[model samples]
Target: MKKLNKNQVYGFIAIAVLSLGVVGCKATSSVEKTEDKTVPEMFAGATKDTLNSGVISWKTYFKDAYLQSLIETALKNNQELNITMQEIEISKSEIKARNGEYLPFVGVGAGASVDKVARFTNIGAMEATTEIKPGKEMPEPLKDFKLGVYANWEIDIWKKLRNGKKAAVNRYLSSVEGKNFMVTNLVAEIANSYYELLALDNQLEIINQNIEIQSNALEIVKIQKDAARVTELAVKKFEAEVFKTKSLQFEVLQKIVETENRINFLVGRYPQHVDRSTGTFNDMVPNVVSAGIPSQLLSNRPDIRQAEFELAASKLDVKSAKARFYPSLGISAGIGYRAFDPGYLFKPESLLYSIAGDLMAPLINRNAIKASYNTANAKQIQAVYKYEQTILNSYIEVANQVSKISNLEKSYSLRTKQVEALTNSVSISNELFRSARADYMEVLLTQRDALESKFDLVDTKMQQLNAMVNIYRALGGGWN
Candidate 1:
């Protein structure tokens, strides 16, 4: 390192210290509060510097090809999401328009007019000429036609209009964040629905398999009854059991169709068969999440970021509203040429130019200003609460999904064992009934238990997968 002059070294130290203080102040100011409030708690934890602060691309986060296609379609064609995107564009335009109001506006213009002042009027009485031009007499009343280049601008004396423009920019940024949040939710929703369709498809397949098995059992019972091996009662019981299971198959079929349509609707298309591989739902190892810290939620959640932007915007809005109490300044200017005779219209004496400045402030009866100020204050308060609520809700969702993931894992294991036991019991009961050692009711009950256990197993697995998807969404990972 090269040695610096003593004074230069001190100056560098001073700047370094100033930068440190600025950064420290920013960190403190951004930290609204602190609590490792898990997802179940009422408020959002602080945004951590680490949560999704790593700039990762969203497309890379979700690598599923089918899911990627659905998200792409939704981004392109989903009505509500597209509308929100347009709203973001509109907000940006408002920022531009507000900025223009602070700067000078210039435009071109043209017009033609024949004006005849009434002889009884003051302007007419003061005229030097009492007679009209030889071949170009003035028309009755005033037919005035004029055209010129004009410009107007509001001078930002108190920085009021400039602040308004900045406020508009803040709102525009908030709208963009809002769209980002929508996208996060949209992508997660499509993934969840797609998984659900796969789960339903698996469920239908299971139900069909169970129905076939039950039908075979029914056939066995009919053969034994015909030979007087069991009785007519056992045959009827088996037939009823088969019919009950077959009824369940229809319910699962309906769910599969409905779930597919739901996915199609999200893809922004008509209800139709959804093409998907059920293998993903079964074999897809859900992404392992690092719940780094409770404070990390602020940065990880889109809703929370959105709420922060709205809070900033609301604060700016309040400032803009307060500015209404002060005076406003405006300036306008125009330049052109005009004359009664067309030949003299461009002459130097015919040159017309004017510039003016206006200062306006509310003196009395300022109900509109007062109302605006009051409304701004009300909205500010509302924004504060909404921000708080969004934080709380995001944390809650994360916590629930995290907890659900753990619990569902355990539930699924138990259901798996339950299915095995019930399946064995069915075999044992059927063998005993054949020897007239067990009652018909025992076989029917055993078969029902086995069916229920299998269904429960599938349901538990669905919850596990759904929890993983939801937790990732709550963590704001997908939108990144």
Candidate 2:
């Protein structure tokens, strides 16, 4: 073999290094363009600076033990969330598939063929195949046996393969963020439902208590009627009021069952009892939220992060498409031994080898390349706007939740006072009915007002609870 001249060795090394640099640049560019978009304004809030208290851990965030258990169970079994887990697995497989393209494809092939040609054909009349054995001579038109290994690779001069691989990687990461966003929404939903269940329980208990109060008033009226302090009409009216309370109690009970089922569905379980604490909902406190700087939201919110990844992936696809317009280089080689006899297959003289390099660029039929490039550009623009829209959405969500948290807290507190006053009126009006100073009409109105106040109080409490849940979700909690 002739030794390569010094200049030839240097040229070869330069080409190799240049090819490697091209591949590296394509991979690096995929995710780096995200820095171009403007930062968004964070949700409207009193605190523009975020309180980066240690990251939220659900175990610690939910001090309520029952709530913690419910959340843990939901994470394990929630159907939609579990399905997203499978989607992430699919994305990971896609990444592997794309990454594989940068490397060579190797395969082996084996074949044996025998054929008889017609004597009328020109080649058939001139040639015949023969095999020599110890005691036998084989004659045929031709019988060939072949075995070989082959490999093919595209030298990524324009880094199309590497860019495609990076795009796959970005998409995989986007899927993960998508799952996280789902997780945040899921946790918020469960928390909201849990709070509603508690509110329902509280309302039911209030109804039962009011029933007892109304029943006592009815008994008093009956006694007064027998003693001639009031007429039988008053007793009938009081009795009706007591019956109405009983009816409402059943309505609340039905609500409790339905709420249980709703929660059961979310937890991915059969309709069954949900362990709960029906303690005073009045004691509930809305979790405080600091609507961190808009920039921080870019990282904290999974939806935003997912959008960023998709944007990065789109840009990479554009680069890959553009690369199609550039020249592509490929190299392949094959080395093996072949012979008519199996014994001679490995002999040096029987060796057959081939190597080739190719450079190709689209010349006439570049419509495909043009179409791809145009589509990639369109998609890249779409991703840019989508990324911007996500930022806007995140900001709006945080702002709305913050307003809800503040306004609802104030509204809930005032409602608590309204309920307190109405509750006292119910007691005073009933006591007066027994003394004949207040009539059945007054008693009935007061009873109705008290019940309404209780319902309103529960509704307000639900809002406060929901605000807390929403604020947490808006701040990008629960994924961790």
Candidate 3:
């Protein structure tokens, strides 16, 4: 065998080193440039207080027992949430797979094979001249049997496999955060729908009460018309108002049914009556919400945290991709027994073992690797944008809900006063009409206005409750 001289070996080593350097520089240059955007420390026009509602648990944040029960059920039975949990599991499996890539793969197996060679071939002539025993000739057909354990491993000199494993871990964590975000949304939706159901119930009650009042007014107007005190047109007008209110009653009823079914769907159950408090809807008040500093969203909001994890994973992916442009070292080994006869397979004379290694690098047709590196860099940039977007969205949601809660409170107060004044006018107008101090038209208009004001008050109250629920979710309260 010819051996390489010292100078030739040194020159080869130098060429390899220079090639690696060029590839490393090229890999670095392949990374795309992107703008650096920093997250804001506080929301615009927000107070500096750190007392956020996000720290509160959903159980404590929502005071209603029925709402708490519904949220619990949804968390356990919701299909989308279950699917997210499975994604988390899949990410965990990916971590295991990536980890295995860096570690040695070992396997044990046994096999048998038969081979027949041509008599005129070189191997056949050699076999015909050789003898396994003094008086025995080589077999015409060869039979091989082996039992062995083998191992193969890739040396992560560039930390490629390690970085890939780390990326998988980050993705697993991101999937978990995604599930938490889903929980927050699911809880908020059920709460808002529950409040809406309560509002619809109140409206239905108001309509029923108005129907009775208008029916009595209609009877009064009919008697007055017969006595020649009021015109027939007045009686017809009163009857028409009663009919309109009765129709509204059905509309509100339909809404209640739809809301209840929506709640059932969220809870992952068949359509059924949802349990809720209908009597105290008018007396219900929204919980006080606290908007903390915007920076808290980075830690508290699930979507933001999820995006942060994805960004981390993407950065690791870029590193792994860049490593692909560098040389990879791999080693393989096997130890086994082999023989032409199965009876000799376990003998020490038939034992065989081998070990080998390889160093491989991409020198040509590297467009695929370069594209992968660029794509990874692009995804990293996208993750950064998504993370920042999540933060901005969280802050805006909280800010909007804070403002909505404040405005809803003021509106509720005004609606209460309006309801009180209109309610008084309704009774006063009825007495005046009976006493001939006012016309039937005035009584009819007062009752209709009073009913509408009451309905509006219920709606405002519902908005307040919905805003409270939304702010809690926006603050990332429910998933903990």
Predictions in order: lDDT: 0.72, 0.79, 0.88
For all candidates, the clash counts are 12, 0, 0
Off by over 4 Å in 1: 1-64, 117-147, 280-284
Compared with the true structure, model 3 gives a TM-score of 0.95
Highest lDDT: give the candidate number.
3
lDDT of 3 by residue, 1-480 (tens): 899999999999879877765765566464443434355576555667889989899999988899999999999999888988999999999999999999999999899998898889999889889999899987768887889999999999999999999999999999999999999999999999999998998888888889999999899999999999999899889989989999898888888889999999999999999999756788886787778887788788899889888988999999999999988889999999988898888889988898998777887789999889988988988887787777778778988887888788888999999999999999999999999999988998899899989989998999899899998899998998
Model 3 alpha-carbon drift over 4 Å, by segment: 1-14, 17-21, 28-47
- Model 2 poorest 10 in a row by lDDT: 24-33
| Poorest lDDT segment (10 consecutive residues) of candidate 1 | 26-35
Angstrom error of the Cα, residue 78, model 3: value is 0.9
TM-score of model number 1: 0.82
Top-TM-score structure, candidate number: 3
lDDT at position 325, candidate 1: 65
Off by more than 4 A, model 2: 1-43, 129-141, 227-236
Once model 1 is optimally superposed onto the true structure by TM-score, how far is the C-alpha of residue 193 displaced, in angstroms? 1.8
Candidate 2 residue pairs that clash = none
